[model samples]
Target: MKSRQIVLGILKSGPQTGYDITQLFQTSFAFFFDSSAGMVYPALRKLEKDGMVTKEIVPQQGKPDKNVFSITPAGEAEFAEYLHSPVEAESVKSDFLARLMFGEFVDPERIVQIVKDEIQQESEEIEQLQQRLSDYLPSHNRCMSTGQKLAFAYGINSSKTEIAFLKQWLQEHPDGK
Candidate 1:
């Protein structure tokens, strides 16, 4: 999805400063979507230019004025249009998988080490996600949308499945044959 659409979707929840939007991308949307301040600021400018959103400047003491963005009716319509559009297939770009494609040339011990490292990384990711969920749910569960909960579940379960698959593979190939 384009950054513009994502910005619009976030604004739909409520008005937010660009920094707040960036924070959401870094935290809430990090699991499924990748975004940066570079992407968000440009999208905000474009959306404003297109009359899809309005920006309000709030003065802050000893700090730069905050640019809070609110979605316009047009922005809501555009976001809705995007939501109703056909679902695109997910594209995964994994360096590990790419390396595995050339595994025959790599030493077996190296391959085993790579797989072990991946397991460790995925385990860490799952732990962080679970912690975020636990922290989020206590206060936000009533307000959290079903889609948000499903996304959390998907992320956790998929990570767990990856760990299981990797462990099974290691068990089946003790020597990384």
Candidate 2:
């Protein structure tokens, strides 16, 4: 989905500053969507220009004025339309996978090291996801929707599965041939 749609979806929850929106992307949306201030500010400007959102300047003591954004009726309609739209195909852009595809050209030792590094990285990701799930799932801190919980489960499970596959492959090919 486009960044504008994502921004609208976030605004649907409530009005927020651009900084708040960016934080949500970094925390809540990090697993499934990649966004940055560079992307979000522009989308916010465009959405404002298109009448999908409204921006209000809020002055702060000892800080810069904050631009708070709120979704307009048009933005809600757009987000609803997005929700009804057909799901896009999953896009996988993995540097490790690309490197492995050309493994034959690289030294065998390098490939072994690469696979090991990937396993470590995936393990770290699984840990972080588990921790976030724990922090989010409590009744007092239930910020994530059921759908988000499911997505986190999928991410953790997939990372575990990938690590298992990599370990088994290493075991089967002890020589890294």
The candidate scoring highest on lDDT is 1
lDDT (Cα) of model 1 = 0.89
Model 1 weakest 10-residue run by lDDT: 135-144
**Which 10-residue span in candidate 2 carries the lowest summed lDDT?**
133-142
**CA lDDT for candidate 2:** 0.88
Residue pairs whose backbone atoms clash in candidate 2: none
- Among the numbered candidates, top TM-score falls to 1
lDDT of 1 by residue, 1-177 (tens): 888888999999889999889977877778888667678898899999999999999999999988999999999999999999999899888998988888999899888989999999999988888887777767444567899889989998998999999999999998999
Give all candidates' CA lDDT scores. 0.89, 0.88
How many residue pairs clash in each candidate at the backbone level?
0, 0
Q: Please, what are the lDDT tens digits per residue for candidate 2 over residues 1-177?
A: 988899999899889989888877776677778777678899999999999999999999999998999999999999999999999998988999999999999899899999999999999989888876776567325477787778898988999999999999999987789
Position 48, candidate 1: lDDT: 99
